[model samples]
Target chain A: MATLAAVIASTHHPFYYKASTAPPEERPPFADEWVAKITAFRETLTRARADVLVMVGSDHFHQLWLDNMPQFLVGKAPFYDANWYNEEREFGLPRMLLRGHEELSSHILRGGLDEGFDLAFSNELRIDHSITCPIITLRPEADLPIVPIYTNIFAPPLPRPARFVELGHAIRRLIDTWPSDLRVAVIGTGHLSLELGGPRQFGPHGPDPEFDRKAVEWIASGDIERALAEVTLDSLWTPGNATHGFMDFMLMMGVAGEGAKADYADSLDLFHTMEAYFTWYPNGVPA
Target chain B: MSKYLLNKFLFTVDRDPDLVERYRSAPHETVAWWESTIANEILNCHGGEASTWLTFDDVEREALAGHDYVKLFELGAHPFLTLTLFIAMFERDYEEPLAFQKEYAARLSHFSLPYPDIAT
Candidate 1:
């Protein structure tokens, strides 16, 4: 029987790539530190050698727009590859990953909506940085097969956070029903903060490190529901814009389950504009 | 004469205090920006009163800028409004057009105004 090996979520800040390849002097202030941390996280994923990766991330208006936005969309591609470029123009994800996306996509949509959530479906779509960046950083070779899941939390009328927790369970149910012998991993990508456009353009990045630390500590302690309840909408939106990615944590916790132990967890403040946290679920089943 | 009539007409319609504040602060400048942008040439234009004759270009620009076209039209006291305009024009007559809109309004009401009067 197929089992979920891990659930991972990270902040998807485009500048990470910009900082990675830039020369030391030319790089953004904390570029070197961020690159090192990202590299280490990637190493963990590669070492795990998890077979199938289920990627959950938000779509910028890049492919789908408000005119035809779907709350939850699953990619039905046989293979998926993203051609992403960095500031130094270095390319990533040289090859595509073979995937069991069709089954995963169908099952997730059916299960999610049956559970009272509206999910969008798509086969003809390009993978965006939200899904691409973390995948490439972790699996530079793109050797593992990927199943992409898109959440519309970035857009309005988003699924309630509690509902997102339910979506996580729906994904678990979908994966359990699959007939293949696949060892699956789940990933959620977005931000831990919300510094947008111009405000983020200036440097020497100062983020609300204290708040970020508190949020991560809650996740590590496995008190997600309490942590979520304690976090107010204003706290997430103001100060440093960390509220946008709270749902990512909720979705991840749902997949990780109450009993699953976290193998790794850390939050890194990057480029003032972006803050990221990552975690891995070692036990496949929900605890 | 046209400016005075337009101003009077605007004052007559029921306007949300929040929207009224945004309009007083930036409506004219925003309209000017839309007029010069490509969308104004495509969406708001119609063969009507010279002052009321907005092209599709105008409508497109307003939509792109994240403004409510229907509300803008009602607030601006235009001669004719688009179907999108009906959304705000008949707020009492209809529920919100999209689920996202309702959630956004609820979540970000500080930034949003009450729905515009629809009877106009």
Candidate 2:
């Protein structure tokens, strides 16, 4: 059986790529601190030495559209082309291609279906920054085979926050039960009190600093009950229009398990959004 | 209220470098041409199998043609779509980083929370 090496969750701040890699003259003043934090966060994954990764992220109307949008979809292909043109245009994210773990993808699809997930599968998926940002941040070599799971955080009539958590729990079960010796890490990224394309956008701090602060506590402490009690589809709008992305973190909390404290947790306060990182070692942290 | 069509205009045009340029420089013409020639075409499908009933309403057409992002947001055309495409077109006009984004926020600052429902 596969080992669940690590369970990780983070905020996928699209600006990090540009902010960290820009020429010294062009770089933002916060870039150094941001890079230092990410480097430390990256070490958590490196220490786990995961062989396969299950990446959870939401599509920003990239491949998935309002027309025929799937609430939850899994990528089960041999190869996945990553990032998109607008990502390059808007965030300076590089185009990427990633290998897929088909056998595990098949297992998850079958197991998820049997578990009543009604999982959507795509043979050819061109992933966007939601999935790629973590790869860039945690595993920049982008060398490991991955199974990409995309949730619909953009469109409305979306799966409620609980559904995302349920799927995460299911994914953890499926990965653990897969008939392979591969060491697997499940990494998911979301936003914290983000207000994109809204009146509060591009502010000095995330639109709702209070919400971001409380959210960090819930995730770091694995307080799923409080998170679920406080978060709802409508309530999410209060923090910021784009705060629905926080549900992805709630999903990661499910993978980490209720009351399962993250072994490694860190955050950086930045403009428009807060950058957060958490990693859990279910089998104890590697020495 | 074809909010879907409104978003489709942003979605399709933003992805194509040529269309982003065309829409940026020639808003009225691009909207008109899109309405007539491309609006009905179903994305990710055979061209002959176009969607015939997806035309934008009068308000949607003008809001897009006039580049009224504020109106588009009011009409629930998906703010992310509106913002991404707008940045692609207009970000270059600003001298400082995020000047356009901050301007965008200020422009819509009058609106309070319990925002317009974005459900399509």
TM-scores for chain A over all candidates: 0.83, 0.99
Separately for all candidates shown, the number of backbone clashes (residues 3 or more apart, or on different chains) is: 26, 0
- Writing each residue's lDDT as its tens digit, candidate 1 over B1-120 gives 122223222322212344334443565554454344422122223543234343334443343234453334334322121211222333334453233323322333333212222221
Q: State the lDDT at A187 in candidate 1.
A: 82
B79 in model 1: Cα distance from truth in Å? 31
Assess each prediction's global lDDT (C-alpha) against the native.
0.55, 0.93
| lDDT tens per residue, model 2, A1-287 | 99999999999988899999999999999999999999999999999999999999999988998768998999999999999999998899999999999998999999999999998889999999999999999999999999999998889998998998898889888887898999999999999999988899999999999999999999999999999999999899998999999999999999989999999989999988899999999989999
Tens-digit lDDT track for model 1 on A1-287?
67666777677765565567667777666666777888877765665557888888876544554435677787877766553222112223333444445666666667677877777777766676777778666776666667788877544545667666777877877777767787778888765544321122123453455656665665666666776576654345453423455676777777766544467776675444445556665553234
Top DockQ: which candidate number?
2
